[model samples]
Target: MRADSFFGKLTRTLTGDPGPTAPQSGGTRPKDLRRARLNDAVLAGESLVGALLTDAGMARANLSGADLTGADLSRARLPGANLARTTLVGARLVGADLKGAVLADAELTGAKLTGALLTNANLSDAELTDADLTEANLAGANLTSALLGRADLSGADLSDAYLTDGHLPNAKLRGVDLAGVNLTEAALVDADLTGASLTEANLGGADLTRADLSGADLTGAAVFEVRWTAGTRWPDREVEERLRALSQEVEPGVWTVVGDTGRSRGLRLGD
Candidate 1:
């Protein structure tokens, strides 16, 4: 597909006209629209796969359910855009600004989003398996129930992010900041969290079976009802003592951490 075809579709969308029917696969590739001013464009549900929109200005655009798979949007300004349920698999979004964007349930498997600015973005239930999000600014992003299996999130800023019930098995999260994040009942089996910070984060009922926690800082973290297996690595002996003091063995090879508020709310491991 030629690059001009993508621009033609964009023109049609801007003029309030319907674009041509998208191909079955490998849609039109957009030309270099670097620093292109495209604010408030109505591009919802369009197929622009492999588009080159590097450093483009796309603030407040509506791209919900759009097929942007494999699109190159590096260093683009996309603040306040609506990309809910969009298919961005294998897309290159390095250093892109996506602040306040809505990406709930988006398919981003294997996408490269390194160094992207996603502050306050809503990405709840997004599929991010094998995605490279290293050093991405995801502060205050909503990631509830998101699938992050085998994703690389090293040096990412996830401060105050909502990650409740997320799947992160075998994820690489070295040196990541998760301060004040909610991770209730999240699955983190065999995940590598070396040097990660969970300060003041809520890990209630989270499964940490065989998860690596070497050099991690869990100071002031809420580990109530957290599940731990034999291979669950602790930061140190003192931290383990604190965890055991606030927990009780519900059954053999199963423990339940409880809060100090005299409440009976706790979850049994391996249940």
Candidate 2:
């Protein structure tokens, strides 16, 4: 049987459409029935992507491993839905409610997620390269090891998100909030972090070579073991001096004896 014909029949049956034409295999279902049902609903324009309903008000529907490439799912409510390993490439998910959704290993490249609420969503190992996440609320989302290369995250709120070992090369993060977020071992080469807040953020072992940090707040941020250059801004001269002094303060009197020996060290300031 043809794939489109099978899909059309399955969609009609799931949506209760009277024109549903049964196929030879008795409208054989996909491997994941719940995901196939959701995909069918999307194809029939009955439910949006990530929506938590089957036209019967079923809560917490599972759509794991569904292929929803290029689907329009604007303003859908999908809280606590299991979308693990789903393919949402180029899908329109503007303002979708995806709080607490498990999107691990999902492919959402080039998707539109503007103003979407993804709080506490598990996006670990997901591929979001080139996705438009402008103004999306990703607070507390676990994005560990996700690939977000070249993603446009302007004005996005990523506060407290766990991005350990994530690849974010060339990502646009202008005006994004990353306070208390852990970016350990993350790759941010050539990424723009202008005006972003890094307060108390842990960037241990992260490579930020050539990345822009202009006007970014790194106050109390833990940057131990991170590789950065003089191009990385330090807020003000006082803050830079403080950090330099702290580095030297670990060994007291180390710089004091640099100018003279033991006899000169005992001499007074005016003597």
Candidate 3:
């Protein structure tokens, strides 16, 4: 049944059997769709730049506004994939599963995504500048308003991450490592963690106001209800007796954004 088959013309244009939503991609499919399954494939606004698609499954695929620049998509499964506004510049996505992937406003500059699972991933307003994400899990991920400049995110888990209104300053984590990161409720306002190591990190309710944690290595860090101030740079030793029963000194260097914190902290960034 070779009726112009590129997976039968994208499975008859995503199973309406009328075809041509935007399906005339260059040379018509088969860009080595390795281990291809393509469940629920729509391939919206398709371009698929530099496609290899190793281990492709593409679960719940819509591929909204797809470009996929420099795409490899290594180990691609793409669970619940929509890929809103997708470009994926310099994409590799090594060990990619992309659990609940939407990738809102995605660009993904210099993307690698070393061990990508991206649990509960949306990455709102995503850019991911110089992205590597070394040990990526991104547990309960939203990372609202994510830019992530020079992002390496060493040993990344990011447990309980919704990360609202993060205007992390100082060139956005220069020489970023983020050692042993959990960054719970991460919104390290004006973040500039000089010499960032952050060992054994949890950082519950993180909102490090004017944060600069110089020579940063909060040994066994928990920092419960952290909402720091006094231009926060608590260099070690003022873990402050583990933040003196939970650090709180808000309303200094004023940075506020109370806009629908994913329905007042019920944060759901993916489907």
Compare the candidates by lDDT and give the number of the best one: 1
| Higher-ranked by lDDT: 2 or 3 | 2
Error of 1 at 224 (Å): 1.0
Residue pairs in clash, model 2: none
Clashes per model (N, Cα, C within 3 A): 1, 0, 0
What is the Cα-based lDDT of residue 238 in candidate 2?
A: 66
TM-score of 2: 0.73
* Clashing pairs in model 3, backbone N/Cα/C closer than 3 A: none
- Tell me the TM-score of model 3: 0.31
Q: By the TM-score metric, which is better: model 1 or model 3?
A: 1
Identify the superior model by TM-score, candidate 2 or candidate 3.
2
User: How would you encode candidate 2's per-residue C-alpha lDDT over 1-271 as one tens digit per residue?
Assistant: 4444545555557666555245446663332123233421323222233332212321255757767777666666777777777888888778878898888998999999999889999999999999999999999999999999999999999999999999999999998999999998899888899889988887766777667887888776765545554454545676555444333222332211111344332221112
In order, candidate lDDTs are: 0.85, 0.71, 0.67
Q: Residues 1-106, candidate 1, lDDT per residue (tens digit)?
A: 3435756655565455565576434664334455667889877877777777889899999889888899999999999999998999999999999999999999
RMSD (Å) per prediction: 5.2, 9.5, 14.7
Output the number of the TM-score-best candidate.
1
Give a tens-digit lDDT track for model 3, residues 1-271: 2323544455444454664556466636445556667878887767777777888888889988888898898889988889988988988989899988899878888799888999888888788876887778877787777777557665666556655553334334533444445566676666666666665556656777777777766665555456666667766654533453333344554332222434423221111
Q: What order do you get sorting by lDDT, best first?
A: 1, 2, 3
